[model samples]
Target chain A: MSEYTPFEMIAYTGSRVLKDERIVFVGTGLPIIAAMHAQLTHAPNLYMIYEAGSLAPILEMGMPLSVGDTRAARKACYLKGLCGAFELTQRGCADYAFIGGAQVDMYGNICSTIEGHNYDKPGIRFPGSGGAGAMAANCEKTIAIMALEKRRFVKKLDFVTSIGFGDGAPDYREKAGVLGSGPYRVITNQALFGFDEATKRMMLLEVKPGRTPAEIQELVDFELIIPPDVKEMAEPTDEDLRLLRDVIDAEGYFLKRVIKK
Target chain B: MINTVSSNIKNISTLEYKEKKFEYWGPTPDESRKLMVNKSHALKDKRMSLKEAVGKHIRDGINLGIGGFVNTRVPVAIIHEIIRHGARDLTLSFQSNSICPELLAGAMILDPDRVSIKRVELAWWGYEIIGIAPMVRYLATNGIIEMDDYTNYGMSVRFKAASMGIPFIPVRDHGGSDMELVNRGKMIECPFTGKNVYLLPACHPDVGIVHTTAADMYGNARIFGAYCTCPEIAMAANATIMTTEKVIPTESIRSYPNLTEIPFPVVDTVTEVQYGAHPGASYGYYWFDMDHIKMFRSICEDFRKTGNKDALKKYYDEYIFGCENHDDFLEKIGYKTLKKLKDMDGGQPIILT
Candidate 1:
């Protein structure tokens, strides 16, 4: 297998995690690329719901730079507005929410709102939760893509923009009035994670080849529930890379970008 | 008042935000209804110049409901006119937007006495793919403006509820998130199912500005793209100032009644301005001008990073204050850029008749 970039690996991993014939509520960038790749390869029946009100768009106009891009609305089966799209999620039509965030905790609560504890004044202000919060609250399962770093994988989030398994309580989601099962998977280039069914804490399911679970644990601020049988993540074949590069993100709008240091 | 049922969100995040009192950011349902009842319901020709339309409704301290989700079909033309008209201490309400609010924020930064945003109630603000909105980061981080955050659905349904003449609507989101505490929404037990549900207060903007694909002189507007909460926003506002890419004949509007997103009665003024959402995409007409958005965003970012208002002021001066209306603004954008953007649209289909 040819070496792939971290974004490609993340996209390929995202595509791998998705099941066929399901709907994914996608944000811009990698999530869209992942859904496109999944459709082109294994999960042709897997459709997408864009927050700007498109469902099952053919994406023939190439990769949409934004979810609100007209290309995202092209040849959509149903196109309404934010209300129509998210109402569908709330009504249980969407199966998976593919999202990204600035910070995440062990329980999978994602933060994309702020880097500082202060709400009014912040050290750095990331974009507020546009649709991820609603998607996380209502979509049956939440799948997050994050850059693996100690600062990002923190013990505490500055803000919980998307709800995961809050406080690891069994009735946390139920009492919070959210419908999602919560925090199904956390995908990074180096590792893939899932929540423990019993504990609702993040569990290391797989790691990249030549990497150790302990090394993955080094990057995270919180302790991950690493099981003994951590398998190596599947590397994207050259064909998968071509599908991602040539077919999905032909303009290198997302796939070819360099990760910020 | 509904008693809180149950929640663990207080223990989840490390955010230490002050508890916001529950209050309507704009008109209450009763006030909105009464305002609608008092207005003339005639199907008169509401066609007016952008200047006149903005002058009539762009008042200080009015809640301005912005239409469009992120970069698509944003009300940039109206925002320019609003900047020129100069509204102070404004309250902006939107689902998600890119250029509209940024333009306003830039104007506020250039001259606060002329234009100011006191607070914003929104889901998100930033130029998608372009970058984080610099003006929002600047204003918010400096504590210059207040913000009430909600999900895209939370804000959209707030307008939807106002349009439906309801006081509040229940949703399943924001209960476990910090939005439940910071935003003016309430969490209550379901009257029927004994389950907890979050209720968002209706958002009835005092003046809603929207740019549409087509509209007649009577202000019956049609949106070809993703509706982007335009229909609800138009109906939710006390007065709606509409700008359209084309002024289709009323005969054409009548030929397809279902195509109308904002009906005649809901809209107060209509201005025919092609490329109305310039820089932002208008699905059937043209695509978003990514370069222009990038250039503007960079300028704003420069101002944010350096606290230098020269470039930002020049941009507003050259584009917004320099122009008489949207036509003048589009003229400055030139035929080539607009043509390229239109070609990029790939002729998405929409019906005029």
Candidate 2:
């Protein structure tokens, strides 16, 4: 319904990962945006629980500055504890766990932890692992959405803080003892992929609207199993683009990170 | 001729022809009002000690107001003093949208007791696992505290009331049906003012403590920059204690009167405490001692695994208690150790898992 920028289209792909009437474990940044779009679209029944204890119904536009963003509070049903999301998911009350990715692997395993080899030594640093360790092992179904490019999609993570694709095949989920099958989906600018429920290996399902499977494949370092049914990703709906633009209230430098030329 | 006494004696009392000297009891010009001079006594006052002060002012039932936002401008030295004394059972109130690190020092490091409050609201800084977001969760699930939240505007409005010594302030915050649950939940009370009004209760601390860059002998404090509502809270409190980075001559500060925030008339005690905002570094003085923070986090993580307070205590004793002061603590968490942390891993990464 609306003109979609490449960025908004990526967000739409992230949002489309959510099914109607699902309980979502929302993370900050892009994940928050995706969940909000899902709520605005066909999945109005989609319920979101953020790290700050907000179980939001209607999320405002833009990336929430933090979990305590007014939008989260404004749209939440109840503000519960932080681990309550995990507890709810553990109890099977929740259906989907949506998170973002700094570095993701073919196995769906994630590295939200350290950047380089040494504990003290680092090339790039971030705040240490949040609740990802627990959520990855426990959530019913996990979805990881990353906007950054291949330097982020590493062959092997420095640390396996979140078990997306771990070990390999049955051994990965088996090693994780994941109550529900761990991370199910991985969404990137290039392609959309899901782990085979049986083997727990990633299967490429779709590509971006303009890009070819071959073009997307070369950028990633890992082997991707392209489904014969792969199709072009749809453009972001009008609401999706509007929300994305509104959330990123940028003035100069910061605005440039996500906006187009 | 002056002694020639006569009817002119009365007339002689006119203006003196020769210069006459006048003397006064006050200090001499060289000794000016020592008000500008910096001064300190050992933390000797009974009620003024960090522990006793927190105990005396903060009772179980009343909501406690802490000054400082998130990590940047936290009153760390005071918090440590409270921890050392082990004051428990508090419903801490904050005016900021999110927390900084110093509060974590309280919840995770010092006091194991749960913080009881109506809301755990902040503007930002709630997403981290090891930070306030997770700590709040652990407490709430265990029924340690209640979550009464307000948005950024609501927090400022309410804190303004507390600082002003008002019982409650009505604001146009939380104004939608989406806010109905919180309103009905009694966290948000709406009075029938014929307009959308939310009544936020006033928060008063028994004793308020703040750290300033400088103070005079009389305890008039001047924060170098970045003034949060600490001064306002000080005005509303029954008594205020200040720990200054250094004490200076009253006259010296008088030369730059506009820089002063708390006048001596409002102050009770002043201590020349260096590195008073430990864990939280001064704005322009230094970046956060992240290496030290990581050590604190590592110790906290170890405690989290064992669920043992003794381990935390041991860590505190080894690192914190062993230090003579904040500098001593900083020395032990050396730059070399901080440099080594990066080598231990690739480095800290911000993955979105």
lDDT of each: 0.91, 0.51
| Candidate 1 chain B least-lDDT 10 residues | B1-10
How do the residues B198-294 of candidate 2 rate in per-residue lDDT, one tens digit apiece?
A: 3444444445566666778676666532344556555544456676667787777678777676766545666666656654444333333444555
Name the regions of candidate 1 deviating beyond 4 angstroms: none
Model 2 TM-score, all chains together: 0.46
Q: Which runs of model 2 end up more than 4 angstroms from their true locations?
A: A1-3, A57-63, A246-256, A259-261, B1-99, B102-353
Per-residue error for B92 in candidate 2, Å, reads: 19
Which docking category, incorrect, acceptable, medium or high, applies to candidate 2? incorrect
How far does residue B31 in candidate 2 sit from its true spot (Å)? 55
Per-candidate DockQ vs. reference = 0.84, 0.02
Instruction: Provide interface RMSD per model, one decimal.
Output: 1.0, 30.8
TM-score for model 1?
Answer: 0.99
Error of 1 at A7 (Å): 0.3
Question: RMSD in angstroms, all models?
Answer: 1.0, 25.1
lDDT of 1 by residue, A178-231 (tens): 998899999999999999999999999999999999999999999999999999
